[model samples]
Target: MKIDDNFYMKLAIDEAWKFQLLTYPNPAVGCVVVKAGKLLAIEAHKEAGLSHAEVNALKTAFLTQEPNSLLKVLEKSSEIHDFLIKNHNGFFEDCEIYTTLEPCNHHGKTPSCAKLLSILKPKRLIIGLIDTNKIASGGIKTLESENIDVTTKVLEKECENLLLPFKSWQNKTSIFFKMAQTLNGSIDGQISSQRAKLYVHTLRDKIDLLMIGGNSVRVDKPILDTRYVKGREPDVFIYSKNKAFSQAIPLFKVPNRKVIISDDLFKLLDYKFVMVEGVYTLLDILKDKLDFVVLIISPKIRNGVNSVNELNIDFEILHENYLGDEKIVFLKRRA
Candidate 1:
């Protein structure tokens, strides 16, 4: 079956969607290689610290090739750069490489992927979305300068969705925090309501970690699993000065979960990768030199209880509504 340019580009988008599974706080990207009129390889960025989409796709394409074969073919071998160059062989010689987003040109944490592509001598490059970061934005220009044919603006909307997080991160210099709440605006009520439990499960699937105070764990007894969402589970982060949670807590059963006990309780728990979650706990973490993002899930209030205030963050009541007997109020942090 002959694959048209549109078909290959769509395949690239599908492959890139896999990055959403593992690229928390990072933009998801997918790549596809069509060599000698055949779909040679396809893959997405598996996780934050793993090899990128380009590297994974190339590795899959060059599986039976020689050691450093990519370096020999492309004349470069700096991890990410070499992966693109080596994989460009006969496949890309007179063909196109479709990527969900523009190739990266910056050298942050690695060399420029664009520079490597130029050396590999691919006949044409098709981009779904452009890079928003200034440092990495001109990949097309870099390729064009080397006389490589480059086409873009295909599947622009899909590309935009994949690159949205990266653009947001580049602009804010922080991870984009997303939270979903009930129509009444509560995550969970005073008691562990079913609706709230389902919301917690949703949050667990979206974030890299599930963070809460020791009090919440003791009160809610959450399992912190993503079984309800059918996606990867986030690591559990408990904000506690000591081991206030019982050994029977469901978080303990999860392999990646960590109990962030302070100096007062560090000796109490023998778990690895511990960090403080609250202001008091953060002080202890700074003292121990540990770092992590704190994710707080504030559910709706049933009566007059304020979850934001408990965290010491000042928020203004935006609106209020009722769901059955439960009272839901929209609160925005006071700037």
Candidate 2:
């Protein structure tokens, strides 16, 4: 009973921050499965081309030790590595997965979670971040050529701050604005915290494209949803040049929503996880089409004036945490 491994790799980096920024262009990653130390399953990668938190925590530890398997082939499925190589039964011999990244060794749309963890032969394999992409890099050298026992920078800086927007969308589509404020830097009066607006409605339910700031859709007629999370809603983008809107703006009567009023932030490169909220003149007009910024603050001290403390902007925070009274942080931009 000795294994700790940073308490299950910090619970697989806190279950990959509940799909941080909502797995755009995929890269949220998470997984857990354990053995003597017990856990069994944890899971993450809940979207974008599907299964990959080590095959949904190795298909929930092979249907939790095959409890009569066939749970609808792991429900909302993608033919997971041929039903986990036809239902992994070797009860993962002394199991111990952890993952946050680095298990994909190619063969798209499912299959090759490092070649199905070298055919379910787990004994050890920690990882946090490594797939430097060549279509999911070597997958920890094919699980050390099936000798299994792998491990790479566990919890590596919270899995590289949850793959900073899938490594800023690996060459293109990035954005990320976010904002919140207060403690004497008023980003509006609501100063946040229904758990920081339910973590911005769970990053607007793993975003697809959000945008907003053209006087925040004509003075906050906002309903840019994900209604505190349950998923599906992001396809808004009101960038603005006002084509006369106001059918009483509940994000324009959300019904199979797709809003897009545009003044074109180059139509946000077609899309892949954009966020962008508002103020500071929409972050100095998209501030070179940002890539990250979150901020937040909120503790209380409302001396308002649309604060980011009268911006000058440079960014570089990288990470900081908190949720209740708020303080978050996250920035980026310094090179």
Candidate 3:
């Protein structure tokens, strides 16, 4: 069976979304290795300062074909690239690689992925979006210089949508508001699935700071730490006029976490990547400043207080998908 480039590239896009926001200062990317139309590996860039998606996928493909090889246990990108270049023995010459983003040409914390692919001489390179970063943008040219068959912009729009957060945060302080609600629009209680909660925790792990209404802090007494994902605790900014609250709030007790209580919203500008969690009242206050809005709508609907407040702001849907019975949407204000 011949491989569908769009199908595999869409799969790669979906894979990359899993690690979105988790790869701070780096773009989330995914890759697939196919040998004679059979998939050898599907991998993604999991974190910053680690291997790119192409390198991880290539390493996984190598180990899948040669399980006992020392490459199986290697984690570093440079080491993996070296092992593959030294031991590949033309294993990937018959394989095609699909990646959501063009492989990087410049070396930073990791080795150059384009250089590795050039040396390996894969049958073809199918990429979604060309890297826009000046330092990393020459991968396509590098691959072509080696006479490798290259296809660009497969599912380009979806790939570009995946990359918006990375590009936005790089240029300015990117802020997004997130809320979990039921089908009836009730934002109260635990409505999201456990998996959805985990997704929020993972996002909390990556952000520099988290902003929430003072009302939420007092009522829910939320721990607000990344306990579910065991990620670094982000600073919390409570948007409240009354600084006097019970000292027993769980967030205040998180070790090494900076908890700030203030009425000023501009304090958000001090951080690069920030998350705001609230309903209509908070959204109304932040409507003009937010870059994105993440809404999680759970399946079950019941009579309760609705999440929406008296707010009028139009949004353009950027991406929408399911997270285990919950519908997650990423929206941006319509320009």
Q: Highest lDDT among the candidates is held by which one? A: 3
TM-score of each: 0.53, 0.34, 0.92
lDDT of 1: 0.57
Better candidate number, 1 or 3, judged by lDDT:
3
Q: Give candidate 3's whole-model lDDT.
A: 0.89
Mind sharing the TM-score for model 1? 0.53
**Stretch of 10 with least lDDT, candidate 2:** 71-80
Model 1 CA RMSD to the hidden true structure, in angstroms = 11.0
lDDT of 1 by residue, 66-144 (tens): 4556443442225646555545455447646788888878775556668767887677788888877677678888999
TM accuracy, model 3: 0.92
Candidate number with the higher lDDT (2 or 3): 3
RMSD of each: 11.0, 16.1, 2.1
Ranking by TM-score: 3, 1, 2
lDDT of 2 by residue, 1-335 (tens): 54577678777777776666656667778889997678988888877777778777877777776667675455544576676667566768689898877888887766678877887888999887887777779988888888999988876887887788788888778788888777676776677878888878788777678887667677768777877666678888777787778779788787787877878678778886688887677888777768888878888877667554355766667666777667777788766
Off by over 4 Å in 2: 1-6, 9-11, 14-19, 30-95, 100-106, 109-111, 124-177, 188-210, 216-236, 239-272, 279-295, 298-302, 305-335
- lDDT by residue (tens digit), candidate 3, 220-330: 999999999898999999999999878898899999899889999778888999999888889999898887888998988777778556777888787787888788888
> What's the count of clashing pairs in each model shown?
5, 1, 0
- Report residue 186 deviation for candidate 2 (angstroms): 1.8
